[model samples]
Target: MLSEQPYPVGTRVVVQGKRGPEVAKVRGEATVPEPQARYGAVLRAATPEDLTRWEDLHRQGEDLKWLLRARARERQLPVKLVAVEFTLDESLVTVSYSAEDRIELSSLIGELRKHTRARVNFAAIGPREQAQMIGTLGACGRENCSSTHLQDFAPVSIRMARDQQLPLNPEKLSGPCGRLLCCLQFEHTQYVDLLKDLPRKNAKVCHEGSGACGKVTKLHPLSGTVDVHTDQGMLLGIPASELKRLPDAPAPKPKRDQPEA
Candidate 1:
């Protein structure tokens, strides 16, 4: 949301939310232009009344969360209630939860509707979303990226770890959500670009310095170094630019099967 008057980061402002005007904190200036439809103009700096309303809405949401949790537990549904959010206008209440399996929420939703006049919505979120809502610290001793700044969850895969030559250890590779770390995707493209000019491990190559043929033992894409196990029984770390790939030896023609005697 833009304002004619510049508000520094962390400034509180009012903007139109899906339900109504909402109080939001400015994080940073928008560097890239986006479709105007994706944004709304900042109405004004938050007023005393706006701050009061915001606090009241937060308290109301917390109260609603407890009610939702109690009902879910009474029904013995396997769900972990994550958050209860009330739209600024008090026209809607969104209930977020995480569950392993599909849940029959009709009974729970029915009871929740009795307590609130607003439209109630039940949102089933995944493990990652759950972690984000909880705002927990990750193994890195810092807040989870998804909770702090990530706007969307990008597709993450084990191949990202492999491309970066990370050890294939699940515990070490997983984030607070127990899924593959979202950060694995961050540097994967860079690693792939670096690897494009490097030889694959175990590939036959000739080292220019020793004039000896060797098999690649390790690749250091970042440092542009290749570890080679030379036929001369020396393991040498040489710059990738100093080595050239050797073509695979042609396979010997299979001996003709002997005729049955």
Candidate 2:
């Protein structure tokens, strides 16, 4: 008697429909009804013969993948069908494929259904899911993140690029998913927090000369000197208080036309 599901004594049971030789198990008639409903009644204890048949079916499903590939080639289809999975009862079969567009798979599905005598389902997955199903190496030469252990995907944004001080080049930052890499957002909070303590780049520091203020060239937080350049292009180090914030500079005036000599 199975503890989860109540099965009548001498009833036939199938496990995953592929485990062969139906095993027979004896159960008392007084088993709880809810557990039986949830786990399903064991039809019978699986026999050794049933186990062998299940293993054979599993192998046949594996071999069917190559057959499907050959069929795709014969049909001249530009799709890569990666996985063929069958339900436990062998009543349904799902084929997973990846292609650039919505492929016309009605004929392929019809052929599979006709040959296998099982309900066929065609799943057109995106590149990420295809990579997951096929299990491939990524651009980094590492096992794909999706197939391994990344259960949750975080949203990667342009703010992450700005915070990480990375360039805004899509080719450099995008991942196998064709979106910004998840790793870029990891330390963004720390960078943003650190940036809050820094002064603006265009801030002007006080210069030593009377009535002549130098424009800020660079900032030195540790040295407390703001590097400044004068109108004549002389570079000087000025203390923080001596540095006065410079107003936004006006745009340059257009040159007047020269009189003909």
Candidate 3:
């Protein structure tokens, strides 16, 4: 709602008037920064009375949510309620539900309208989206990036795990979405860049001080370490920076005249 006086940033205001009275935080000037003003108007600043009413409405909204769920149970709705949001004006309540299969909520909505006499908005969301809306920790023991600050999700794949040299185990790679963890893609480019300078696994590499050639068995990019199978039949973890990649040994020629014997 537009205010006659500029409320500045962090100003709280009530919108939608009495029937609506939607509460919102002001980020900055309401309208687009232009000569002609075109923006929604704020009824007035959020007074102590408005704050009190907002609290009461929130409490009532929570109660109403339980009541709605109870009604759903009575009617046997298949959807599970993940979250409920009440408009400040109390004109509408939005309920988010998740289900494995298609949910026909037409009958449920009809019953809710008759019971509450208020607008009820229903939103069907995926399991990952539900977790995001409610906020959850990932298997990494940290707040989920999607719920915290990630604006969008990119397509994650098993190839991302292989690029990072991580095990292909599902439990280790899975996220709250039951798909591959999104963070696997975060530092993937850096790992790929590092791989360009590292010798291929199982290829011959020369140790600087030992004057011995060894096959690279593994790579540890973070610590710049490589596990080498040495000519002396020893497995050693050597710093990649101290080793030189060697030209591959020529393939042995196939034996001939074996059929004559």
Candidate 4:
């Protein structure tokens, strides 16, 4: 959101939120005054009254979360609560949750409505969104990118790991969200470009440095290296730049079909 008056980061200001006008904290500003299509202007700095109301609503949201959990437990539902948000005017309450399987929440919503004057709304969120909302440190030791600056999660895949010559271990590959790390998509295009000219696995190639013929075994995309199992039964790690495909090597295979995103 853009503010009419410049405000430092952490300043509380009122802005139009999805539900209605609400108080939000400033996180950053553009150094350049770039035009943006979706920018919403900040109405004004939050007054003391607005801050007080926001704080009260936050406490109420916490209580509502507790009540929601208790109710779900009583009904034996598998919902894992994520967050509860009340509109600034307390006209609506949005409850977000995650579940492994589909659940019928009509009865649950009806029961929750009795405890609050605001209209009750239940929102379903995925594992990735849940992690973003909960916030946690990633394997990198920094805060999870999804929870920090990433506005949207990019599509990550096992193929990305494979292209980058990463181990296929699930524990090493999965992030806190239990999904493939978002970092996998970061350098995937560069890896793909670098590997495009390299010989595929199992192809016959000659190491120029040693004049030894070998079968390509593995690729290290970032380092531009290939692992080879020589015909002499010796293993060698040679730079792709130092190797050439053998004349007798079979024709390169067609590109594998990609799965839908």
Candidate 5:
């Protein structure tokens, strides 16, 4: 997959813009196309010169941010300028921003082009992209997953939460971007590995209490105990093997947490 490709190092290019060209340091090689369309080419490697140019461009971006904020206020719109990225060729400048709804940005783009004397391009991004630009700490007590080593995003679902027995509250399960936690993908494999040896949740088990079969309620792998709820609503603990796998039991949920892919 393109996402799995390793990037090369030490390539430098100027991203062109209407105002002027800005330089960016390639942080890593591009394995996949950036989710947005502003990027023209796959990222290669970064050089020291590229880093220096990137810093300059970042400063310019900050200045542009202030200008955009003032413009947004003047235009009576709720919009935020997230970032300014220069093309590798230094011929085009792309301005990435976010707004609740589309606004007529042609005038704004024209104004920027006139002021900077470079081709100006505008891009709209989501809150997730905004978080990536600003960067933040994650639940793991480290840099955010998007800003750090995570190169690709995997689909995360509520089923992952149910599998891990995690709280369903949005705030607890979501990241700074108000999306499902990225860490859910980290430990998924462990759960899958352990589940291979366990009985299904709804399987029938031998109950020592009334000498009758009971529905399996839960399995405690570490203690090797399986709790079964009998027909009479009584809970009984028995060895894991005492229960038989039921044809009707729902398939065990996929492991939602793994350290690495």
Candidate 6:
């Protein structure tokens, strides 16, 4: 498989064991630490001949990307081409695109097959994959996570920001994918775990050292402290370690059933 291909991390390779040999770049140790079984195996590292062929294909591929876009526009197809790839043997030309709806591309494929004289394949992608192909600097000014380290896209949502107590602003929260930042999923579990033993909001609790009973008003997971709204109508910052949970008030004894008069 592509991951198990024992060529160097960044080596250009011709993948074997498919309908036709596919050319793939070594994603390498940084992105894929462990080689996962992909669609193809490392047939061989690219030789001068292979590189020459790829160079030729590369030029044509770039043109194909634009040609597909142009053709789509000419035909009024509501799709935009994002990328194009040619297998080492020219057996397949994979074209990636973005579209709101499934715009039929059969006629487009017919034209591409004629133009490139290769088997053509179409792939529709979401904003996340679009970001992966067209990488951008993140808000942190680093390479986009999905494009660099994170290979698979994990679902991100606003709830993750809420769990981490981050400001709910779109500009700050969104990534190049125009979705909640991927970093939220990375740290969310730690925040959730830290909150498990902590008192809930408005929970009646007592500080063991001071013996003060109050309702929990605020929480600081990182600091392991929470501000308590004391019965005295004052806020007291209490450490979770020194807080003793009070048992629920016992239900009053059920009133004795009275015989009907």
Model 3 C-alpha lDDT per residue in residues 153-233, reported as the tens digit of each score: 677788878767898899999887786787998999898888877788888998898877789988887777889999999
Q: Model 4: residues >4 Å from true position, as ranges?
A: 1-7, 13-45, 89-91, 110-117, 247-261
- Give, for candidate 2, the lowest lDDT window spanning 10 residues: 15-24
**Measured by TM-score, how close is model 1 to the native structure?**
0.86
Best by TM-score: 1
| Superposed model 3: Cα runs more than 4 Å off | 1-61, 87-92, 111-121, 139-142, 246-261
List TM-scores for all candidates, in order: 0.86, 0.49, 0.64, 0.78, 0.67, 0.78
lDDT of 2 at 161: 79
Task: Give, for candidate 1, the lowest lDDT window spanning 10 residues.
Answer: 31-40
Candidate 1 pairs with clashing backbones: none
lDDT of each: 0.82, 0.63, 0.74, 0.83, 0.66, 0.79
Q: Per-residue lDDT tens digits of candidate 1, residues 80-178?
A: 888988766778888898888998777777766777788888888898898887888888899998876565688999988877888999999999889
Candidate 1 residue-wise lDDT at 2: 55
**Candidate 1: residue 238 Cα off by (Å):** 1.4
Would you give me the overall lDDT of model 1?
A: 0.82
Better of 4 and 5 by lDDT: 4
**Per-residue lDDT for 1-261 in model 2, tens only?**
234665665555563222222232343353335443333335555667666665665676677777888888999999988787665556667788888877887767766755587677787776667666567666688876666544345566898776555668988787776766656766777767654544455565455455456566565554555667777678877666565565777876666785444
For candidate 2, the per-residue lDDT at 192 reads 70
* Model 1 bad stretches (over 4 Å): 1-5, 15-22, 30-44, 250-261
